[model samples]
Target: MSPIRTIVLTLLALLAFAANSVLCRLALNAEQVNPADFTSIRLLSAAFILAIIIVIKDKSAIRHINQHGSYAGALFLFVYAAGFSYAYISLSTATGALILFAAVQFTMLFKGWLAGNKMGNQEYIGLLLSLLGFIYFVFPELEKPSIVGCLLMILAGIAWGMYSLNGAKSTKPLYDTASNFIRLTPIAIIGLIATYFYFGLHISYKGLLYTTASGALASGVGYTLWYQVLPKLKPSIAAVSQLSVPIWAALGGVLLVEEPIELHLAISAAIILGGILLVILAKNKH
Candidate 1:
């Protein structure tokens, strides 16, 4: 690919990342669909679309799914999807994205430590800054938008972290994702069924459309594009590039969704994203 094409593709992939938060917030904020049902729809749609793509584009990815994916990965995938959907119920697009992004990095950093990887001074300092930033973002009542929403976003982030960790272990990223989503089907069904019994389904056609777009376009296509972009990017460039996601989401919220922004949110988002960027770059410096 040409340099221009690679850069364009990279930008598009980042936009897609931001789009997921915008789409989710738009749907949930409107109360169009229940989180559980939206999650099921999102997973099923993403699986269907990604499966078809892999079938035509690379069947080898699906050939040895058992070797590439795990139950834990599927569980984490489901948890991320569910928590993400629910968290958006009361959270703004930018705020939720920042919290989710921070939690994911923290989880990965903690997991690495558990796996016997020691952080350098910069990494340690970055981790502390990230934690402090996150706490400030969610505490003191005035800074918090919704305590429940914050916690749910954090859960989503951690789940996403586990999913990322597991996916990194796979030799084939596309195939691993396909297999994980396939495993996620039964789990999604159980949750949907339980949610139905309790809260019942809450989906209008507009809501269904939003959820479908989120799955097929924002997630399924977005992930494929990211995988394509990854090979073209330096690790540090990739890491730094993602810092745009929350910023984009926040801007999209302000303009497209008309969501209000608070000064504290902006400050905290900077601290968290800045800290994570430092940690990532520090690790890659070696």
Candidate 2:
């Protein structure tokens, strides 16, 4: 791929990832769709789009779906999706994005450490800085995000991180991801059924529209673009590039939802991103 095309695709994919935060906030905050419905529809749409792409790309790949996926992977995906939607009920787009991404990075790094990958001093310092920054960001304050919301988003991030860790071993990432989404169907259905009994299904046309766009455009197509560009980029570059996701999400909140970025958020985001960048650079250093 041309350098220019690669940059454009990378930005597009990042933007798509960021959009999920904004879209979920928009849908849930506005009460257009309940969280349960949003998660179910979003997962279904993403799975459908991804499956179609796989078939179009290679018909034989369809057969691998059953072989590539696991119930555990599907559970992680479901938890992430469901927790993400519910968390957005009380979280601003920027704040939620920040927490989610930070948790994901730290989870991956911490897991690597537990797996016997030794970390340098710089990596440890960076990890500590990021963790402290996260704690300070969510600590009780006048304008702090809801404790419940923060915890749910953290859970969502951890689940997503686990999902990514599993994917790291996959030779066919796209197929594996597609299979995971497909496998999540039964879990989502059960959640929706329980939701109906408890919260009662409440969905609007606009809600359905937003979830579909989120799943199809942002998630399905977005992940496709990311996978296409991932192999061409160096590992460090790919890792650091994701740091922009929260920033883009913050920008999206301002532009798309009129969400304000407060001073606390700015400071915390800087610390978190800076620390994460440090970790990535340290890991890639010779």
Candidate 3:
């Protein structure tokens, strides 16, 4: 693919991912799908779809997971999917995306430090600004937000951060992305099943359809594209691009779910977007 095509495709992938968040929220809040059931079905469906694609396209991809790099990648994916699904039960889609991406940014920064990447002064300043914005956004939500939901989302973000960093480090990028899904599917399924038992929930046909679609399109295909793009993107660019997700998800909520857009949400959006833009600009200077 040409550079322009690659960039466009990457953006498209992000949009699809944002849509996934909206869909998950819709399924949980409207469709009455239990968060745990949704998570389990989505992951299992995604795994099945990807498995079929790999078998048809390249059976050799299966070997990639057994490589050392895949262990960390699979773990990250497992934790991320599980936590993310559980969080949506009580958290607003916009709030959840914002928090998750913000956490991911911090994780990436830590990864950079460990990798001996030199952090420019501007980067540090931008990071501080972004952190403040995140705190501002999350502070009010904590008073009445579900504790279980908040904890799950935070854990999910940590998992995703690790997944992205590991992907950056892996030598076998293609297989790592593909095989990571395959390897993590069984674990994700187990978690989902356990969640079902603990929560005492059942999946309806509508819930299954929505969750499965999210997994197949937004997650399964979307993540494959993401992993393909990750190796090519500068970490800072990747992180900043994710800032758009909250805005998009918020818009989605307003349009689809009719969620109220309070003054604080609007202000928080501006601050977070501004901080992310600053980070991107500062990184460009180097």
Candidate 4:
């Protein structure tokens, strides 16, 4: 592929990932659908699109759908999806993305340490800075983020961290991801049923459209594109590239959703993402 095409695809994929937050916030902010219903529909749509992609790639892939993913993987994915939707109930696009990004890196690093991976001084310092930045972001002095939203987004990030780790050794990332989405069917159905019985169902056509785009284009096709480009990029480059996700989400929020960008958010983002960059660089050097 040409360099221009690669860059274009990469940018599109990143935008798609960022759009997930914007879309969720839009749908929930409009009170179009409850988080449970949004999550269920999102997962189902992603599953449908991913399955279609797989079938197109290899006609026989349908028969092997059950041969790839695990129940634990599906559970983690569902937790991430559900928690993410719920968190956005209160969190702004930028704030939720920042918290989720921080939580995911922290969780991944902590897991690595527990697995006997040694952290150098730089890594330790990076972790400390990240923690301090997170504290400052939620410290209640500045705009004051929602405590429940922060915690829920953190949980979602941790679940996503675990899900990524679970798939780290997979030889076929796209196939595994698709299979995992397919496995989410039963769980999504149960959650939707419970949500309907308890909270009652509420979904507008607009809500459905947003959720479908989020699932199919943003997540399903986004992951596919990312995996395609992964081989062409260096590991460090890939790591560094993700730092732009929150920024894009923030832009989308401000321009598309009419959300405000507080001064504190700017400062906190710089600190948190700066620390994450330090860690990424340090890891690559080590």
| Model 1: how far residue 72 lies from native, Å | 2.7
lDDT of 1 at 219: 80
Off by over 4 Å in 4: 1-9, 141-145, 227-235
lDDT of each: 0.80, 0.83, 0.77, 0.84
Candidate 3 vs 4: which has more TM-score? 4
In Å, residue 170's CA in model 3 sits off its true spot by 5.0
Clashes of 4: 0
Per-residue CA lDDT of model 4 for 139-208, tens digit only, reads 8833544788899999999997787567555667678778888998887889889999999887888988
lDDT of 2 by residue, 83-173 (tens): 8988988889999999898888888878878989898899888988888888778875426558888889999999978876665556666
**What TM-score, over all chains together, does every model reach?**
0.86, 0.89, 0.88, 0.90
Give the Å error, residue 162, model 1. 2.3
For each candidate in turn, give its C-alpha RMSD to the true structure in angstroms. Answer: 2.9, 2.5, 2.5, 2.5
The model with the greatest TM-score is: 4
The residue ranges of model 3 lying beyond 4 angstroms of the native Cα positions read: 59-69, 118-121, 169-174, 192-201
lDDT of 1 by residue, 115-204 (tens): 897789998888888888888877864455588888998999999777765655556656666767778877777877898899988688
